[model samples]
Target: MMKYSTSPTPSTSSYPRSTSPLPAPANYQPTTASAAVKRYKYLRRLFKFNQMDFEFAAWQMVYLFVAPQKVFRNFNYRKHTKSQFARDDPAFLVLLSVWLFLSSMFFALCIGLSSGQIALFVLFVVFVDFIGAGILVSTIFWYVSNKYLSVDGAGGDVEWGYAFDVHINAFFPPLSLLHCFQILLFHNLLSHSGFLACFVSNTFWLASIVYYLYITFLGYSNLPMIKNARAFLLPLPALFVLYVGTLLANWNLSHMLMDFYHYRVL
Candidate 1:
């Protein structure tokens, strides 16, 4: 019987054990889990209405319209006190969602859409147009700012949630313009197909886009650790050129949008 002694494994066991932990992957990040936790907490707070600061949110909305730059002061304060650039409260998001729902519903009704169609339109606009598109845009800007616009030794980075907040803040004016104001003016003024209608509608769009860009600039510029925030405003001239091009081409963007919505839901 050839006895292979299990204890005779000195060759295998004699190697020195490395006390240093194995290196993590080059791209492995713990911040991903922290971000996920923050996102989860934000979503969880959505259902807890009693815990939301709606009145402050309403004030913030008003400031977003009248004095958007002032809104960032609160974010700055939040950074100082809470040590984060993003809002923990979901009141703003909830209020914006409610406003979006109401505005889209009324706009659909004004366009003579059927009840069922109106519901679908609302869903498409709120979910697809607002939330979905907002997330995409936020992610793009977040990545751009973090990857490209970051300073070398700033010791801080842009927060994805903060980027999202910036997007929604910028999105508010456009939403009001296109969904609420344009609908109000549609039958009376914008329904006509002419240069005058084009000018009015196009100007609304231009102003709304300008508002979006300006607010976006303010949001990024307000971040203490961010640099070259003026890059956000670079698109304005291009937007102006496009606005002119659309006008010269006699494109009734509002009409085109209405048709698109009709095609989608009707």
Candidate 2:
């Protein structure tokens, strides 16, 4: 009896309501539960690389090599050349090598004059090879994906960003794979403390072989036209042999330089 009737418990229709239709969802809104899972599955399948590591390598290379248009053109060159290591930006590579070498020397001199200095130099070299090589590999991927690998046989005409989509996709695997090899090389190199580390630095040699194989496989796999595994491997073996010759040449040059310095000091 003491309780009020609460104004007839407020009829369901008593609440204020808008007469206009509800707003549509924004375009950038996240997918719902089922759709989100589906989207993730597709993304995972597409990338086929370690997500976080690949992303880091991609970002590093992106910052290091950010030419908008020419980056993709290089891929076109690679497609025609068939596994040839075409030089896109020689000046950039030379400048980076010089900068890294000089910077390492400067740091080595500043820090100490012992095996420790050499160790630091080696670390710097590894960094340059990993990050610098990362940029190169990313650029290559961008080109091939844009030029050769296509769902429909019709990619695009040679425009400014003919390979923009391919470039975006290329940023990940090559860098990820390269970084993985770099780690392996660093581990092997650091484990020893001599100038002529065992077998003339086969760490990078083997790593490069692995990297080349992966790139060839990736390119062939993505493209419907060039699916012949045998055809792909033919060019790769020759490239690998050439790379070995280059490695030996580089080693001999470094050895001679060191010997000259030692003689001059004596």
What does candidate 1's lDDT look like per residue over 59-177, in tens digits? Answer: 77877787787677667655654557798899989999999999998999999999999989988998899989999999999999999888889777899999999999999989999
lDDT string, candidate 2, 192-243, tens digits: 5454453344434445455445444433343333323334345666766865
**What lDDT would candidate 1 get against the real structure?**
0.83
The Cα error of candidate 1 at residue 209, in Å, is 0.7
- Taking all chains together, the TM-score of candidate 1 against the true structure is 0.85
Candidate 2 Cα outliers beyond 4 Å, as residue runs: 1-136, 151-200, 219-235, 243-266
Segments in model 1 whose C-alpha atoms lie over 4 Å from true places: 1-33
Error of 2 at 146 (Å): 2.6
Among these predictions, the greatest TM-score belongs to 1
TM-score, one value per model: 0.85, 0.30
Task: Write out the backbone clash pairs for model 2.
Answer: 75-143
